[model samples]
Target: MAGSVRLIPSGFEFVDDVWGGIYRGGSYMLIGARKSGRTLMGLQFALEAAKQKEVCLYFTNMRPKDLMIQAASLNFDIQSYMNHNLIIVVRVAPPNDAYAVPNPDNYLIDYLRDIITVVEQYNPSRIIFDELTPYIGFRNIELLKDTFLNTLETIEERDVTSFFVVGEPATEKAQQIINAISQYVTGVFQLRKSQSKINNRFHGGNIIITPNVGHTEGQFNFKYRIEPFKGVTTAPDVDDVPSKYADIKNSLAAQQKTAPHYVYTQSKQDKNEREVFNNVYNYNDFLLILNNQIALYKSTGQTFNLVSVKLNAMAQTQGLISLNQLQNSVQLSTERKDKICIKDNVLMLLIVRSNPNSVVHFLSRLKSNLPSDDIDYVETVWENISILNIEVNQDIENAEELTEESLNKAHQDPGSYLPVNKFI
Candidate 1:
């Protein structure tokens, strides 16, 4: 007899002492309040999978373009992935009665079928629904529950990992949706703010991961920061930082400077030195905060000239021209006169196009300054230029080899259509 097939664990896997672990294959849900990093966390998970060479599908019901820009701003390498067809992003408008009604039975079924079609086509290892709360708002609770269960069942059948982000409940109706989904989820990761017992001081939010039914629960505290790269850093160990830093009570007293009379009588010079030390301490703290924010932005996988170049390239690809085109466009005489330089980790193009109105005339000349690896980047810059405006006779067409329906059909019968190994 064949051995019984075993399902793999799909919970958090800690990478470092302070850095938070990752969620592997399984159906998981993230429940949190507004502005609580729900969408950001989903994006982080998708990015992590991408880094691991697993295809990711992101489905959004809100602010899809804004999310794309946010991802770009964080330096997520989205363009490179898009160019390679490694990631697929789709957006759907929220159902009209989804939030107002108790259940949207057929409507949700249709939506799920569409999603399933996409999944069958892409065969992504990871799928993320940015927020499911809006969908549950106006729909029937029972139907919503059944729909979620069906979705999970479909995912399990396909051996795909999934994540759903749900907002905090504003009413009993909302809570019901959360309760229903939580029952079927393979793991639940809850995010909530809490106060520290040791110092009686408020700390950051806590992340608690509860495995489904019989699995062990994992919990951790994480603080978001931006720096050399966008990623999570573990909270500093209590034993690592000086005890004085952790002692809020003593630290508050120190700020008040209400020590004994002997301390006050020490000297004016001593008091000045103490003031200097305090200033240094405050500055260091501020730097740490700024660094974290910067790191968070970096984690989005975008670069300084990312949006500008993409917009420009998209415009040119679409046959549009603007004032910005003159600067980025290369000209024959200018190419011979100016030099290309790589400074501060950025490629700079110096062009001396004399004719301001004829940016397209210099396209060939500018092409020389761009490296083969960066040609796509330059093309994207022109595409964005065309996207902005300025009509031209050039016929640019984008031919996609696959569609949602076809992709789904391929997945349903992989051996007959898709590559044999793709099913495995």
Candidate 2:
């Protein structure tokens, strides 16, 4: 029996960490939120199967064919497989002509028929449907689901493994539709966003794999990261940085002295040294705070703004003058504690739980704080921060050993898919 086929070498950390490998003859469903790397995840699996000299068919209804090809090439470097005829693409055009046609009800049927024809023609070992969300827009949900199930059954009988990418359900109705479809697939993998406790940044989501048809040798709930060039990668250790950035019980000590043009009315210290007021904090600390706020905002829809201020060389040469100027500006319109800091000579203001109107006012005030001669020269940037969720895979590092035939297949023409200019 062709029980399991390793899509990538076990030596590759991604294969070992995320998925032991995709099982042979498995129909999988990848479900994730919008822009959560669902399409990329599907493309990655398709590319891996194609690398084994297997015919792979990709079908997408979300993006244009040219743009999808461009993204696969630019982001994952998978264009060569398409060039070599190992990967075939089929784009499902939307029903723009449905309203004009005499028989508009046949749109779904026609679409599925076209897909089946392509699948039969390609005779691919692996098939990837870029998305299954568009079906929800159709009026006959039950019929579409029935047709989809029948299609999958036909593909399975032919020994062609398949993957279907579905957007994360937004409403109860959508969830019900997905639940109905989920029962037919061999496996269901949910991709979602998981915040890093250590860094407080959106690394990627935990992939929840629930095996259905095959023997459940390995299933997982693990964190994964979506990387550029390479699609998915195991995230760093969780405890790399403790979640201590938000432990600010008291304010950081203020400068002792004041600048000639700027004054800190809210400052505590009274030291005479002008150099003592260089308000810069460590860059890493800034990242920690930024990540923490991002996670906080994601959990609670409360808003926060990040304002970055970059000063020029003339301002830096004057020691604490630039720092005092920025501090005075931020303090005038923004909260002092837990709001303003200089990271690597750049001043960053964290407008906590504030809306857009107030943030704009704060930016204007900060701009006014700069020196009259150099006010126009200084650069200021601001953004409303939000959490980004990315889709990734699951893992089973020490799962059951593969059969000899499967192992032999993994080693055949190992680097055939690798370009000569792989480093490039």
Candidate 3:
């Protein structure tokens, strides 16, 4: 995408004038201490972007109706705006919603998929994420990066802009997450509460964009206030630096540098007499295959094995070469010929109508490939691979039982591989 011809206003005149507002196709972050008006700033930007004719996707944990009411309180009236497609509010509550409603059986994966689905369906020009704290802690870092962050590359390719709202970190670990998250975004803004009162005359709080995304110079030092109907406003000022900034010093430096981004594509890799073949599908697409197979099992009672394999390589090129070789093995050896899926370390194969004997033949064929060769790393050979599940003939049962018992077993148990006997 070309450099942003125009910028999306943050609904704050001071910020718009200084930092050039938000650039199109860029990812930005808004983090603040508790009650520092972070959500308000996010909402204000969504309203302003919508008014400027940008299709804005507003994701909030609040109920759709409640969020609309909140926006209306700030004079945005997002309901009508939503009716006209100017702004859309989607409720993406994390695990906390399990108490108020019946959560999805597979909550985390389903929720992430829902997010990607909405982005694809709406094709919004601007996306405002109200709060990312629920998903960005130390333990949840991989979960967030592996799923949602990857979707962000597609969002950038679409030339859409985004602002992620994050909560202030009270602990050292949480602060570390803030540092890690800053590198991925174009820049970060630290918002804080002021010692003064919340009245209009006094500064409501302060905000500063670290490593300013625009041409603005010097360390950002601006105070913000909440007007009766105008929402949050900013003005140039100086005050105690936000504690959040101290922890993310190195992170800001990293964002200022250049980095290479890798984009993964889905394409046909091999062909047969009947049709072309996909070497591997992403995990999300593989879910469709899994669901279809389960549906077919309900109808025809056919059995299949869910196999997960790993390849050790030092670089991406070597990994791709090994993956292609593995694909060749599957095509030449296995009874079924279908597109397999690989993500991170695991490559998944759906072996159809296969028993233990057939699985052994497939393994033997893979072993027949002999010692592999790769200069970038040690010889790239199969490692820690096993048939994770065998959905064979069983008594008639409901789909729900199958989902929780058979389908998710492999997903939950990545290390459940057992020793395999010699295929020969």
Ordering by lDDT: 3, 2, 1
After the best TM-score superposition of candidate 1, give how far the Cα of residue 196 lies from its true spot, in angstroms: 13
What's model 2's lDDT at 423? 15
34-133 in candidate 2: lDDT tens per residue?
A: 6566776777776556545566888887554554664564264445555444666666666677657665546656666566688786678888888867
Best by TM-score: 3
Give the per-residue lDDT digits (tens) of candidate 3, residues 1-424: 3355445455655555555455678888888876677777788888767656667888888776667666775887776666445677776657665335453323555555666688887778888888877755435555555555666676787788888888888888788777776767776888888878765464477777775444334357676777656777765543433334333433323432332221223322212111213234555657776767776777897767666554434333544445545554555444435447655545666786766676667677655432233432222244423445445455534333433443344466644544333223
lDDT values for all models: 0.48, 0.54, 0.61
Error (Å) of candidate 2 at residue 113 is 3.2
Residue-wise C-alpha lDDT for candidate 1, range 285-348, written one tens digit per residue: 3334333433434465221110001122334446543322333332211433333322211222
Better of 1 and 2 by TM-score: 1
Decide which is better by TM-score, 1 or 3.
Answer: 3
Q: Residue 247's C-alpha lDDT in candidate 3?
A: 30
Worst 10-residue lDDT window for candidate 1 reads 302-311
Candidate with the larger lDDT of 2 and 3 = 3
All predictions: root-mean-square deviation over Cα?
20.6, 27.1, 15.8
The C-alpha TM-scores of every prediction are 0.49, 0.48, 0.51
Error of 3 at 408 (Å): 27
Candidate 3 lDDT score at position 64? 68
